[model samples]
Target: MDQFTLNLLVVGATFALYFGIAIWARAGTTSEFYTAGGGVHPVLNGMATGADWMSAASFISMAGIIAAGGYDTSAYLMGWTGGYVLLAMLLAPYLRKFGKFTVPEFIGDRFYSQSARLVAVICLIVASVTYVIGQMTGVGVAFSRFLEVKASTGLYIGAAVVFFYAVLGGMKGITYTQVAQYVVLIFAYTIPAVFISLQLTGNALPPLGLFSTHIESGMPLLAKLDQVVQELGFAKYTGHSDTTLNMFLFTMSLMIGTAGLPHVIVRFFTVPKVADARASAGWALVFIALLYTVAPAVGAMARLNLISNIYPNGTQSDPIAYEARPDWMRNWETTGLLKFEDKNGDGLIEFYNDKSKNEDFNAAAAAKGWAGNELTVNNDIMVLANPEIARLPGWVVALVAAGGLAAALSTAAGLLLAISSAISHDLIKGSLNPNISEKGELMAARVSMGVAIAVATYLGLNPPGFAAQTVALAFGLAAASIFPALMMGIFSKRINNVGAVAGMLSGLLVTVVYIFLHKGWFFIPDTNSYTDAAPLLLSIKSTSFGAVGALVNFAVAFAVSRATAAPPQAIQDLVEGIRIPRGAGKAQSH
Candidate 1:
């Protein structure tokens, strides 16, 4: 069957399964909607948390970025994975012991200030909403390809499927849905890696395959990739050309950001006990490692495969003629992901890093009758195109399409849940209506879900490239604002409402402003006063500014606390209570 038909069947089947599960697990109470009634198994919650954590950024974007970025890209893997360790150790169990339905609730009560809760709600919304934009775009992009619909139309379809499960089930719905999604996404991700690894390196294990000799070249796979890419004027596949300082800061920001994100931290609240929260985190890491460790292999192998196809006789030989490129390239060309221009008019495509120009490179291009680079390949295409690039069957390609959708939709659901809970549970019920009925609160949650979806759809219509960057930015924002406040609330007895509020706002404002100055004012696409290329502060890129923001937050909060009255005795007692696992309650605290 044709690829499109196969994609439809595969994607459609997964959607049906998700809808079935959502219907079976429809939430019945506010508690169910909020924290799956706090009764999930550690292993089950671990799987669900894995799905919630690995969004479009992890599944679709990470490996592709790594493929293009090579060694410097390790920041994403190291930072993101390491953040969970911090979350599990420093935050998860304490928050679970606090017995709160939402992160803002913990902040509000521990600080003994409604205003502090409001600030947390704002922080959560900013981070979660921004994060959803990318997942929405991922959904739209995946649908546009598999369904052959306009990007916006495909987005609506995917959003509708997510709404069916997420709105109806809340935490209960999402918990089970994410478990199924984790299975689908991991299966889809690993199957192709296995096939490609065996095909390219004659090794069944992808991680081992990365170091194994290439089937065609006697050299190790990474060495072969380095040689071929450098021959084409690209950096070596395993070279660390980026400044070590920037890499360290970026990784640090990501790690801090991961531990601070509300959506991810909220998953720990679903388990029955503080101990379960800790165990679940360990399992989540194991599940995450399954894909994380395989990604470099996929990246290295896919890069090698593409170059080998374009230069069948080797980089020293004539390049592939444009008219004679493979059908997969032709297919991707229609999506604007693969572009070509006959710059040299030899009907051949030459792709290399123009930025890596040198005397030898110029001389080689002249001798080879090559003009400037004639191909522009988007990095995000590497993973999506891996199956086709390796000549895998149509079924595998369709499964990948499904997997990408699952990744995007699952994370989008988790983020939206965080956004809605902040609005309804924290903003409306906590502050606006102390006496609001449970049904009224649930309705508010659903309405908030609708609003978040609308905003995400609008952004996804022409999603910025940075939409793919929300994962890191969200983590940074969380690290800078939420994580510090929460940590101090549990670990320190003197941090009062004033200190907490000041710290959160200080961190949030600095991080957001730094991002805006470089990324453009509000990411409006062209209104920025500065750029990450030449940052205003310490030559640090805006993306890595989160760690700085976090440091500032800690300093400001301590200074403010020293100047202000200590937290009320009631609040101090509450913090002390949360630090230990005893006296934990069954029902969530308002």
Candidate 2:
């Protein structure tokens, strides 16, 4: 079969499977819609959460980014995985025990203030909407590549698919569908990696291959890769970055952000028991680690493949002719991710690092009639192009395309669900219309989901300037604004509504302002007062500012709580009640 038809058949089959699950598990009640009636078994919930947690960035972009940046990208791995530990330990069970449909409900009830809930809802919407843009845009890109549709058309189609199941099935539909997606995505991700590992190192497992000897070179795979790249004036495949402190901060920001993200946290609420929430988190991380460990191997192998492609005669020889470039390079060149300028007009690709710290090689390449690096490969394409680069079978390529869409859609559903709940459950039912019927609230929730999808798709088309960094920014906002408030609400019963609100505002504003100053004010390009590479406060890049924002939140909240009177004793009792595990299943029985 032709590649396109195979892609259609596989993708169509997976979509059919998900749609079937959505229909079978269609939500009938508000309870079903919001929390899947709190009946999800911990393991299945964990698998669903794993799907919801791993976004397009994780599935499609991580390996590519790691390939381009080398050891520096380890921050993403450590930070993201480490966060589940914090979430499982500090947040998940307690939030599930507090027992609300959304994060804001707990904040409002725990603080005994609708106003604090209002503030939390605002924070949730901001952080979630920012995150959704990336997912929607990712869906568009994945659709454009595999389905061969226009990017705009793909975005609308993807949105319609999500709305069909997500609006109907709610949490029930999404959770079950996400389980199917997890299977598809993980299979797609690991298969090619396993093949690449076997080809390069004679090892069946990718993570093990990363450290094993290269069958051809006789040296460890990573060491051989480093030796070749460094010989070509590129940084070592596993070298540390110049900005060690910034990497630390960035990793910390992602860790805190991961724990704080509302969509991820909400997954715990679907399970029946507080113990289930804790156990589910462990399972979720176990599922998540499978892909996380494979990613570095993928990155390292892909990088070696590309460099070897350009220098078929080894790094000591002239480059391959431009006309002889393979199908993968040719196809990506059409999308402009892979480009060559024919520097020196040699008609051969001159691929090397233009800004290497080693000046001797820079001068040597120039002396060798190499007029600087002519190949401009976008970092994003490495993973998507990895299969073709390795001459893998077409079915594997199709699977990868399907996997990318599955990843994007899963996370998009989770984010939209979080946003919709904040609207219907928090703002409408909890505040404006406390007397609204369950059926009416469910209707409102569906309506809100549709609106959220439309808004996300629109922003994807004309994304705010910050959309490129939306994932990181989303995490930062959550880390600073949401995480601290939830922590203080549980750990410190004395934190009044005023203190919680004050802390959230302070953290949120400072984080946003710092990002804007570095990225752009309101994300307008070139409007930044300070670039990340330029000097900024405390020698921290804006990308790494979330941890700092979270600290500010803690300090301000504690200081304000100290200066003011303690929360009333009734609220104190509520806190103590939540601290125990016996009655959490009925926390919302009121």
Q: Give the best candidate by TM-score.
A: 1
lDDT per residue for candidate 2 within 292-380, as digits (tens), equals 99999999999999888888887645788999987778766655446789879988888888788898988888788987788987555
Q: What is the TM-score of each candidate against the true structure?
A: 0.96, 0.94
Candidate 2 segments exceeding 4 Å error: 149-153, 462-469, 521-535, 586-590
Model 1 is weakest, by summed lDDT over 10 consecutive residues, at 524-533
lDDT of 1 by residue, 1-590 (tens): 88998998998899888888888889888898889888999999999999998898888878888888788888999998898889888888888888888999999989999999999999899878778987887887677767766656778987888777889889888999999899999999999999999998899999999999988878888888889888888877788877777788889999988888888988988888888888899999899888899998888888888888898888545788999999888877766657899887888878776667567876877787777888877666678889999999999999999999999999999999999999999999999998999999999999999889988888766554633465677777878888889889889999989999999999999999888776755546542122344666766777788898889989999999999898878888988888887556554746
Clashing pairs in 1: 257-475
**Which parts of model 1 are misplaced by more than 4 Å?**
150-152, 366-369, 466-468, 520-523, 527-532, 587-589
- lDDT values, one for every candidate: 0.85, 0.84
